[model samples]
Target: MSKIVILGAGHAGGSAAGFLKQYGFEGEIVLAGAEQIPPYQRPPLSKAWLKGETNENALQLRSSEFYAENNIDLRLGIAATAIDRTAKMVAFDDGTVEPYDYLVIATGSRARKLPLPGGDDDLLLELRTIPDAERLKQALGGGKRLAVIGGGYVGLEAAASARALGAEAVVIERMDRVLQRVASSTLSEFFTRRHTREGVIIRTGAEVVAVSGHSVTFADGEVLEAHAVLVGIGATANDELALQCGLECAEGIVVDLDARTSDTAIFAIGDVTRRPLPHYDVMHRLESVPNALEQAKRVACAITGRPAPQDEVPWFWSDQYDCKLQIAGLPFGASAQVVRGDSDTGSFAVFHLKDDRIVCVEAVNAAHSFMFGKQAIAKSSRVDAATLADESIPIKETLL
Candidate 1:
């Protein structure tokens, strides 16, 4: 029987293993993961789970019995030490070697650590893993103050949760706006106002100069005292195993259009894979659950001699308090950003245009418009801001 081994049991790894069977591949499958528990969903790690509204069982992607029933082998908590392409084997940290005909590397990323001036790992924590959230939750214990280092998704979500827990949350972002890297400035402004109303101090263009114990010093000589600090700053790709195998590495392990690495026999997906998008013809490493699942399905289809699905426009969303923001497509060099509705009323979409082409759409508390915009962009259709602003035109027609 042909054997397939997959590394990292996150969304991509779990989906890849499940799809192999869905496609009627009569082969032995092994899933190796570094986490001690079964495969779990990551999207909630920062939001629901942090709010104490979720548990480990809710985070699991699959039940424990799912593996045994499907005849799939799951090796949890076993870190893949190296991949030996010559022998088609994977070396584990425990000195065990597993041979396979096909391999998939989905090792995601580690939370980028912030360099503080003091030796205070106790006060500073990152919200990447479950344990991290648990520790932060225990620290919250009702009323307190939390200083979030980055104003990105992770940071803002942390700030929102801190506020939900009845804590005074202050978010300090180096950029002039929150979520500036992913969402448009208009969307950022909407969220900034929302956070401000919730009693969370939103500071923009403020860089953290140093951190000593529970005190954070800003570049402008401003300092604040906090009970605990959550570093939601950024992430760094885990490429040690790939580098050991001599695979082409850039910011991540470089993969071609079909998710093939320098070695065609191997494949990389999710945040760790630096692959090129067909629509834009540019390399991108997106960190979203949708992208991970899509890449996994595509790689599985290719391996099983099935036709790959058409690539859809990439998108992501975040839930902070009651605000639901959704974004579609990548807006590179977007020359103009137009708002479709009243910004203060809590419903709007930021239309992005470049030389008259609708490159992307940022919707705040507007799921209908966001979904329609995603479909429009996926079909490569042209949409005008004037019609988009007018609810009478209807966004669904843009796809037609």
Candidate 2:
């Protein structure tokens, strides 16, 4: 019997394993992970779970019973230390090896840390894994003060959760505005104002020179003190395993449209892969659950002798306080943008257009616009800016 080994039992790896069985693959499947816990949802680590609204059982992607019933060998509490590509073997940290007819690398990214002068203190915390979230959750109790190092989604979400727990949050961003890397200035300004109104202090265009204890000093000699500091700068792809195995890597493991790595026997997906977005004519390392699920489906179909899954208009969402922000499509190179609804009313959608063609949509509390915008982008439908700007007209009618 053929054996398939999947490294990293996170969303991508775990989903791929289930998909393989769903697609009628009778071969042996091994799901290996470093964490002893079964695969669980990571997004909730910063939102509902952190706020104590959900329990550990609610975060699990699959229960232990499901894995055993499916005949998947669950190798937990150990990591793939090395990949001997030529030998078709994977060596683990616990002095064991597994041979495979095929390999799938789903090792996700790691939380990036601040490279400050005094950043080595144990007081600094990151919110990535279950353990990280548990520690941060403990620190969030009793109206503690939180000093966030970055103003991105992770940072902002944590700040929101901190505020919900009666803790004071102060977000220090090195850029001119929050969400600078991913969102538009209009959206950034809206979030900045919203966070500020919620009693979270936001410092923009400020550089951090050092971090001493819970005190953070800026380049201009400004100081911010708190009980605990959370670093949400970003994440670095865990591509060392791919690189060491002589696979092509740049920013992440470079995979083709089919999610195949440089070596034919290997495939990569999820946050660890720099995959080609054919529609956008660019490569993107998308870190959304939808993207991971889509790639997982594609790989499963390929291995099962089925046609590739149809491409989708990539989308993502974030929950901060009561606001629901949903983004559809890539917003790069947009020549113009149109705003519908009213930001003052906390319901609006920003439509990004390139040569009068809709490329992206950022919807805040506007589900109809997001649903319609996703369809428009997938179909490459044209839209009239005048009609899109008019909220009186239905979003479905805007598509040409």
Candidate 3:
């Protein structure tokens, strides 16, 4: 029987293992993870789970019984020490070695820390793992003061959750606007106003110079006090494993459409992989669950001698203070943008167009628009900007 060993055991690793069995691969499958817990969802770590609306049980992707019943050797709380490509073996930290015909790397990513002075203070926390969420959750309660560093999705979501818990949340962003790297100015302004209304103080263009305990000093000589500091800058891909094994790696492990790394024996998935976009020729390292699941399915099919699944149009969603924000496609080269609804009412969708074709959609509290926009972008459908911008017309009708 062929032996397939998967590292990470996060969403991508776990899904690949389950799908391998479903595809009738009677191979010996081993899933190893650094976390003590079973494969669970990470999206809720900053939102629902942090708010105490759900427990660890709800976070699990598969039950402990499922792994046993499926004949999967699930190893938890164990880290893969190194990969020996020549020997086709993986060395574990516990001095155990696992030989495999195929190896999949789904190591995911770690939360990036701030580089400013005193950024490593104990009170400065990052939310990437369950333990990180637990620590942040404890601080969220009792109406404590929260100073969030960074204006990305993680930081914004943390601020929203803190405010929901009756905490005084102050978001300090160095950029001129929050989400400046990923979102448009209009969308950023909308979220800023929304957060402001929720009693969350948003300070854009404010650079942090130092962090000491619960105090954050800005470059502009402004100091902010908080019970705890949450750093949600971004994440760094876990690509050291690939680099150590002589795989071509940039910001992430470079993978082809087949999810194969430079070493064909090894494949990569999840946030750790830098893959080519479906339509665009450029490589993108997506951190969303949809991207992870899609790559997992694709890798499974390829391993089972089946046709690889078609590359999907990447989509992601976030919930903050009763607002559901759904984004579709990558808008890196967007030339035009159309607003479909009122931003003041906190319900709108920003349609990004390139060469008269829909490329991306940023929908806030607009599900129907997001669904249609996602499909339209996937199909490379072209629509008139006037029609797309018209709220009077249904998004479904706007599809070309």
Please, what is the whole-model Cα lDDT of each candidate in the order they appear?
0.83, 0.89, 0.89
Which RMSD does model 2 reach against the true structure?
1.2
Please report, as a residue range, the 10-residue window in candidate 3 with the lowest summed lDDT: 391-400
State, as a TM-score between 0 and 1, how close model 1 is to the true structure. 0.95
TM-score of each: 0.95, 0.98, 0.97
| Model 1 misplaced regions, further than 4 Å | 119-123, 396-400
- The global Cα lDDT (0 to 1) of model 2 is 0.89
Candidate 2 least-lDDT 10 residues:
113-122
**Per-residue alpha-carbon lDDT of model 3 for 1-400, expressed as tens digits?**
8899999999999999998988888889999999998899988988998788898888898888999898899999899989999999999998899999999999999988778789778778998888889999888865599999899888889888888888999998988999999998889998898899999899988978899669899877978888999888889999998899899999999999888999888999999999999766689899989999988888889899988887688899988888899999889689999999998888999988997788899999988888888888778888988888898887767766
TM-score of 2: 0.98
Comparing 1 with 2 on lDDT, the higher-scoring candidate is 2
TM-score of 3: 0.97
Candidate 1 local Cα displacement, residue 196, angstroms: 0.4
Write down the worst ten-residue block by lDDT for model 1: 391-400
